[model samples]
Each structure stands twice: as structure tokens, then as C-alpha cells.
Target: MFSPFERMVAGRYLRARKAEGFVSVIAGFSFAGIMLGVATLIIVMSVMNGFRQELVTRILGLNGHINVYSLSAPLEDYSIMKLQIGDVPGVTSVSGIIESQALMTINGYSTGVMVRGMTRDDLMKKPVLSDHFIEGEPADFVGYSAAIGRLMSEKLNLKIGSTFTLVSPKAKVTPFGGMPSSRTFTVAMIFDVGMYEYDSNFIFVPLDAAQAFYQMGKAVSSLEIVTKNPQHLNTVKRDISLITDGVAGVYDWRDNNSSFLNALQVERNVMFLILTMIILVAAFNVISSMIMLVKDKGRDIAIMRTMGATRRSMMKIFILTGASIGVVGTFVGTALGIAFALNIESIRQFLQGLTGTELFSEEIYFLSKLPAVIDWNEVIAVIAMAFTLSILATLYPAWRAARLDPVEALRYE
Candidate 1:
């Protein structure tokens, strides 16, 4: 606790007179550095957090949490498999998917895409496909119709009720050779999952139609499953393994996309370390400025000591003076960071409009919009780290001021 006299002296020292202009400039620079460092760290971390969360949501929303595939052959009697998987303790829903790589063409425009076949009921189980409809509604997903992505629809110049030909390599082969199979399917639904790749490269069709087109009979490529808690899928996976009895292979989303997720985590950690250095540099600036302030005010420290000020009081005064910069800068920086992060997308768009260029490209980032999610815990951690550094930075300089000898300081002056 600072005494009234100590607080007054600290406050007086912080206020710059005309003769102390250079010291004030140094203090100002240190304040700006701390402010910018904290703000940059918060904004970048928020964006990274938001980016990872949004990707996970869209990926798992469309793909489910776990995948089951036949180890020896394609999954036959998939309906029974679905029912058994659904009955598992943590299991929520199981959808049989007949996936095949095929080229789709219309009016001389063609692109290769994955065709995922699902029954209407099974399609409804996946919220991403069932919920997102930019053009047609869920009721139209019946019969031989297909659900396409928004980007695909745009690229091929398609619309509701527009027909496209899907050509598959798998077909019945006679004595002549092999003939590629092709079928015309009307676009019943167009959806946007917000991810650039998934939106542009997937087509969904009725299970019966897909089976007929692929000559798959009643077999499915795999079983896509959702669970109550994806994070604890090991137990569910083991249970599913027992239920399937070695007929299938089971894996979770983490297993399927481990490398990509690990990459994101690594990048997040690296960015945090790199940004923390900025704050560290600002702390160094605080130390340098405080030391200089102590040296410049040596005679003042001597005079105050002669006026009955204790050494402890001198230390407290200097500490308070230096810490004021850190505390105030951190508070202002925190407010600025949160405000900027919350409006980052709008700001990005505004900049893009002003520059006449796309700022957040869906093709490069796989997301159409910039995201910023401020984790309160992370923000608290940042504040604690900065506050601690600021307090520590003032210690040595404050100690130096407290140790000043009145005779030595006055004799030199």
C-alpha cells in the first residue's frame, strides 16, 4: 500500500514538465508499444480460434463424427448395420453413404466431383445437408433428384429443375470391353455449407438411384455416423467394433483428419509464442524507461530522502509511477482489441471495398468470411501476463532509486 505522500510524488513524477520532455517521449513510446503489442496478440489469437472453430463446425456438420467402412468388401445389408450402429450407447444416427467419384457435364462444361447417395430419411440425419438450402427445400429431395452445392451450381450455370449428366467409370462390361455409365439427374436442391471445397465438389442423390447408377446392388461405400460426444469417440468406436464383429473398420473424425487438425493446433501455438515476444519487447522498453527515469531523478530521490522519506517509500513511489503506464496501456489495449476483433469481418469488407479487391478469399482460406472469436480465458491470460511483466519491469529501477545515497546524489548534482 502506498502512503499519500508516496502516491503524490509518484503522480507528480508521471506528469511531464517542459524540462522532462525527452523522458515523457520515451514513456509515451513504451506505452504505445505495450498497447499495440497486446492488441495485436488478442486480435490474431481471436481470429485463429474462430477459424479453427468454424472449420470444425462445418466439417463435422457435413461429415459426421465417425466413419465405418467394410474392411474386406463394400458394406452390404447397410440398413442393418445402420440400425445396429444407432443402437450403440453413444451413437446418435448412422447414415449409409454410397460414394463414387464421377464427372458431371452440362452444355460442354464438366468437372469431377464426389457423388454421395443417401436416402431421404438418412439425409435428414445430417444437419448440414438437411438444413442448408439456398435454392430448393427438403421436400424436393425425393425421386431421382440430386442436391448440389452453391459453387457448383454457379460454375455449371445450374438452377432448380436444371438437369446434369453424371458419368461414372463403373459399368457392366460385355465381350467388347467396358462402357462408362452415365445418368441425367435434375438439381432438386442447392445448398451452401460455407466451405469453398465442400460447396463446390459434392453432389447428393437418392440411395436407390445411386445404387442403380453405380451397379452397387444393395451395398454402400461406408456408414457415416454421429455421436453424443465426438471428443470421447474411442469408447464408442470400440463398442461399434464389437457390434460390427470385424466386418467393418471404424474411425473417428480425429483419426480421419488428424494431420489437418494437428497442423491447425501447431500453427496456433506458434502464433501465440511469436506474438508473446511483442509484449516481452514492450516490457523491456518499460524496464529501460524506468531505469532512465530513476537515473535522471537521482537528486530528487536524494532530496525526498532528506525530507524524512523512507527507502521503502521511495521504492513504492517509483514502482507506482512505472506501473501506471503498463496498467493503463493494458486496459486500453484490451478494450481496443476486443472491439476490433468483434468488427474484424466488417472492417475487412470495408477495406476490400475501398481497395476494389477481395480481402478474404474463399478459395485460399476455405471460408467465405473472416472470423474472430474472443475466448475470455485467453483474454484473461493475456492481461495477467502483461500485468505481471509490467510489475516486474519496474522492480530493478525502483530498487536503484531506493538505494540512492543523499550525499553521493547531491554532491554529483
Candidate 2:
């Protein structure tokens, strides 16, 4: 039985090490370049993907997938609207939410806050808020109780059972002046969502308490709807709008955070492209090495041609060599990438402590730590790309080797 052309060429290239010292070094560098590039690309992309996933899960967990707000004033019949919206396809849950600007004061320390009022039953449905009590109970809001964010609590120096006055500005007709303002309630509990913006600005109070404070008679600013599948948020929003006869404006998660998501996607793509260049440059090194190999083995090639070795066979040999570099490098890189992605949190903490500075500060990046999410599709793509570039890089040198005339090569030798 005859050996296949690919196998013969691969075996020969693999064994041709003694006289090919420089070629080996070039191949090694090519492998190293691809390994580093692919690993870096995977790790970076996974981290970005992780951050994006965390944002959606955390933010959407607290804030519903869609919000139905009145275009004119407050929603008239929140109960009826909730029922109607809940009946919409894909709508899993609906809750009425009231938002008002208020000043919270304790011990002469005053801070402006956005009070989010919700019923105890509705509060339980919000996973983000429900899991992050850290201090007090949501059900305790029946008697002037409030759940403040962690940052807000820190800034105001508040704790559980701490009494703080909530001064909400309300327009009232006065005899001596054009307008008069009235204050609202008192703070009760503090909550932390691990997100700076929410923790620093938002406070949760009882729905009835907020209604009385704002002089709203059983009306809410918006009805937050949670869907079974977030990908169908627009569909859910549209259904809600149709059910309400277009009287209310329905907003989906995409509308609320499109810019941030877009930025994350752009950054991921840019990073991949940049890192892929490293592998490309390394593939070019393979080209240089193959060209050198052709020069060094001119005599051997001429003798082989004289002995009836085909041009196609010579080309296969060089191509196989280049491809082997890519294959080995890709395998190593993929392993390293998966490992790093799985342990990114610990790696991030180590670096943070080593640098003596917080790498992912909640105050700065909206997250307190790094995140990494490995996608197998991305891994497959990188491997395919690396192998393709490696094979492509061999074309010119392989062609030159194949085109060499036996007589000319022999004469030079």
C-alpha cells in the first residue's frame, strides 16, 4: 500500500528537524504567537460577555423587562391596567411602581433620593431587590418603613431601625404665596443591589405610603411587566400597548439600555480583531520560515524532483508543516483560555490585591468584580480562523517550492 501524499509530507516535515534548526525556531515563534493571541482574545471576550450577562440579569431582575407609563399623567386604573397587561402573551408578571423625588435627612446629613414605591407582593417578584435585603425586610414598609440602597445608607450613616425624615416637595395653595410645599415620610430600611446607581439613588417604600405622601389617589406612575422570555420584550411591549389602546407608552429593556449594550458589543468585536492580528502576524512568520526552508533544501528538492517527486507533493509538505504549527498552538491556547475564563474572578482578586487598587470598583464600573463567560462558539471560531490563516500563509512559499526547476536548482547546488 502506498502512503497518502498528506501523510508522507506531514511525516517527512515532522522528522526533518536536524537540518531545519532555524525553521523550527520560526515555527515555535509562530505557535507561541497564535497561542498567546487566541488565549488573550478568548479571555477578554469572555470577560466582556460576562459583564454584559451580569448587567442584564441584575438590572432586569430589579427593573422589569418592560415598563408601561402614561403619556399624559399618572396611570388612571393601575389595577385594571395590571390585569389587562398581565393577560398579554409572554407577560409573566406585572407590578405597579411609583417613583418620586424626595430628600432624606438623618443627623443633619441630607441626600436627594428617588423613592420607588411598590406593594409587598409586588416587591417579592423583583428578584434583584428581593435577594439583596442585607438589612431589613420589604414587608416592614407598611408603617413608614423604607428600603434604601447600600451607598445611600453609607452616605447617610443609616442602619436598621434608624429614623430619617423624607421631605417630598408637594405643591399646595397658600394664602400669602403662590405655592407651598409639603414633606412626606420617614426612612426605615436599607437595601443593597451591588449596583452604584441603584444603591445610591433609589429607595423602596410601601405603595400606599407613597400614594398618601404624593396625594395620588390609588394611582401609580408606571406598571412594570416581567416577561417569560426577555428576547421577546418588544413583542410583549407591543401587546401591552395594543391592549391599552395606545394610551400608555410601553418601554422594553432594549430601549432603556441599548447604548450600553451596543458599546459592549463594539468593544468585544474590536478586541477580537486586534488580537486576531497577532495570530496573523505569527502566520506570516511561518511564511518566512517556509521560504527559508525552501532555500536551504534547494539541493534536496532538486534531487527529489530528478527522482520523480511531484511538485504537488513538495507543496503539501510545506503546507502540512505550517498547519501543524497552527494546530498545536490553537490546542494549547484553547485550553489556557477556558482555564482562565473559569477562574477569572480569583485572578481578578489576586491582581486587585497585588496592585493595591480595586480593578472593578462598583463606584467606577457599576460592578465590584470581573466576570468571564466562555462561549464554545467563540472558541470554535478562533480555532477555525487560526488554522485558516496558517494554511493560507503557506501558499506563496509552497508555490515557489513547487515551481523550482530541477536543472536550475541542481546547477546552483
Candidate 3:
């Protein structure tokens, strides 16, 4: 409960005179420091959060949440495993899948690719793959035809109806020691999953064709199971474990990409702590400026004490004065941070165009675009932390001003 007199005095002190310009400048720096610190913290945190969310969505969209692989051999009884896993309460769909590494050669160029064997119906269930058709049709996906990513198609000069040779290193034994297995398949579909890794390294083919190519008759490499939510996969894993008789590798997307996700989280936390020091430094500015103000207005305080103003009044006035800077800065910073986060992609593109440089590259960061997602709780916590530090910074100066001996102060004046 700040009184009218206290507020009036605090306001007057904040409107610095010609002689108090230096103190006011310090206060300005304090305000700026806090504002920039809060803004930077919010922007960085939001970007990290968005990056993690986008990665999970794309990764899980292409791959299953839970992957069950047969430990000793190829999954010969995948149909039974699929049915049993499909019955799990949280499980959405279970499909037989075969994934293997092979070299694809075309137009005198060769690159390593992961061959994924999925039925057309099951492929359509993946929104990232099904919806991102850069230059292919759904009808083209059936038969001996295969689907290739946009990057793969671009790099190897492939298109719908164009064929490429897949060379498998797993050679068959023959009279001439061993011979490599190789086959040519037509490209019927092309997709851009927006992830550089997937776009450049993945090829999809129908299940039966993949079985024939891989020489695994009625056998699959693994079972891919999708869940209603990837975050709540523990119960789903337990249910699936009941079906798998106990070996579930890559039980969820987090497990599959643990190192990458954990790095993002660790980097986020470290950045928060590092950036918070900016606000902490700003609080010191508040303390230094407030102490200088008290020294400069010592005579005025002596007069006020002599005029019967209570010590509590002096303390309250100074608290209001210093806190005004911190409070205003925090609110302004929050607004600036949210606005920046919302338009981060547009801003990044504009900056890139203006500067003629690649600011965010898909090859390094994985996503084709920069993303930002603001969490309001973090914003509130930042504001509170800054406000508390600022108020605390004003305490020593305000206390010294309140405890000034009127007679002793006048003798010096």
C-alpha cells in the first residue's frame, strides 16, 4: 500500500533534474539490461521448444512410436504380433515393416539409402509422407514401383517412371564364391518430408515387393506400432511387451533419438542460466544508481526528516522509484519477446534475403524453417525473477536514506 505522498515523491525523483542526469542515465541502462535479458531468454527458450516439438512431429510422423524387432531372426510371425499389438488400448495401428541399408545408383551417381517396405495403405497413414507429394500420385505407389524423397530424386536425377538400381551387399553363395544381389525398381512416388535426413536418405516400396527384393519370404525385419500419443507410451509399451514376449527396441521416439533431444534440453537450460545473468547485472545497476541518488539527495532527506516525514515513507518512496524501472522493463520485454517469437520465421527469411546468406540451414538444423513456440509460464517466471531482484537492489539505499541523522546531515550541508 504505497501512499499518495510516497508515490508523488517517487515520481518527482524519477523525473531527474539537470544535475541528476548521471543517475538517470544509470537507471536507463538498468532498464535496458533487464528488458534485453528477458527478451533474449524468452526468444531462445521458445525456439528450442519449437525445435524439439517439430523434430518429434516429423520423426514420429515418418517412423513408428514403438519399434519391435525380432532379436534372433527376422520376424516370421509378424501378422500375429501385429494383431496382438493392435489390440493394445492406446495403440493406433501396427504394421509389418522391413528396413535395410543399400546403395542406390542412377545417372552415374550413387548414394546410400534406407529402404523401407510398407504397404500403400500403411504409408498413407503417415501424414508427413502421404501429404508431402512434391511430384507423385497415390495411385502410382502400388505394384513394383517405389517412392523416393525429393532430395534423393533431385540428387540422382530420378522421376516417376524412371528406374534406379538397388545393390545389396548381402551376396548369395554361388559357384563363383558369392554374387551380390541387385535389382532395378521404378520410381512411382516422390515426397518432401521437410527433414534433410529423411528427405535425402529414405526410399519406400510396397511390402510384397520389398519382401521379394530382400529375399525374406513371409518375414519382416520389424513391427512398427503407432500410439495415440508418443509422450504417454509407457503403458502402451507395457501392453506391447505382453505381446512381444519382452524385447522392444526404440519403444518410443524419445528412445530412438535420445541424445539429440537431450542435447537440446541441456542447451536450453544452460542458455537460460547464462542469460539470466543479464538481468542480475541490471539489478546491480539499480542498486548503484539508487545509492548515488540517495547520496545526491542527502540534504533533501535531512529536510524531509526534519519536516516529520516517517522513515517508512522514505523507504517506500525509494522502493517505488527503483521498482518502476524493473516492472516496466519486464512488461515491455515480455511483449517484445512474444512478438519476435511469433514472427521469427518471417524475420529469419527477411534477414536472409537482405543479407544474402543462409541463416538457418536444413542440412545442419534438420528442419527447413526456423520455429518458435512461447511458453507463458516461463515468461511469468522471468518477469517475477527480474522484479524481485530489482526490488531487493533498492533496499540498502532506501534503508540508508531512512536512517539518516537529521542534525548530523545538516552540519555537513
The all-Cα superposition gives candidate 2 an RMSD in Å to the true structure of: 2.6
Against the reference, the lDDT scores of all candidates come to: 0.89, 0.80, 0.88
TM, every model: 0.97, 0.91, 0.97
After superposition, which runs of candidate 2 have C-alpha atoms over 4 Å from their true positions?
1-20, 176-188
| Model 3, runs deviating above 4 Å | 246-250
Listed per candidate, the RMSD to the true structure in angstroms reads 1.4, 2.6, 1.5
Against the true structure, candidate 1 has what lDDT?
0.89
lDDT of 1 by residue, 1-413 (tens): 88899889889988979898888888888898889888998999999999999988888888879898888878877787788889999888888888889999999988899999989888777777677888887788877799998999998889999999999978668788788889999999998888898899999999999998898888888999999987788889988988788688887899888998999999999999999898889888988888888988998999989999999999999899989999998999999999999999999989998999998889999998899999999999999999999999999999999999999999956
| Model 2 / residue 33 / CA error / Å | 1.0
Better candidate number, 1 or 3, judged by lDDT: 1
Candidate 1 residue-wise lDDT at 371: 90
Q: Per-residue lDDT for 65 in model 2?
A: 88
**Local lDDT at 185 for model 3:** 92
Compared with the true structure, what per-residue lDDT tens digits does model 2 show for residues 198-301? 88988788888888777788899988888899976666767787877757888888888989899888998898888888888888888887888788778877
Q: In candidate 3, what are the lDDT values of residues 137-248, reduced to their tens digit?
A: 8888877789988888877778789999898868867998878888899999889988999888999999998888888998999889888888888888877777777444
Which 10 consecutive residues of model 2 have the lowest summed lDDT? 178-187
> Candidate order by lDDT, highest to lowest?
1, 3, 2
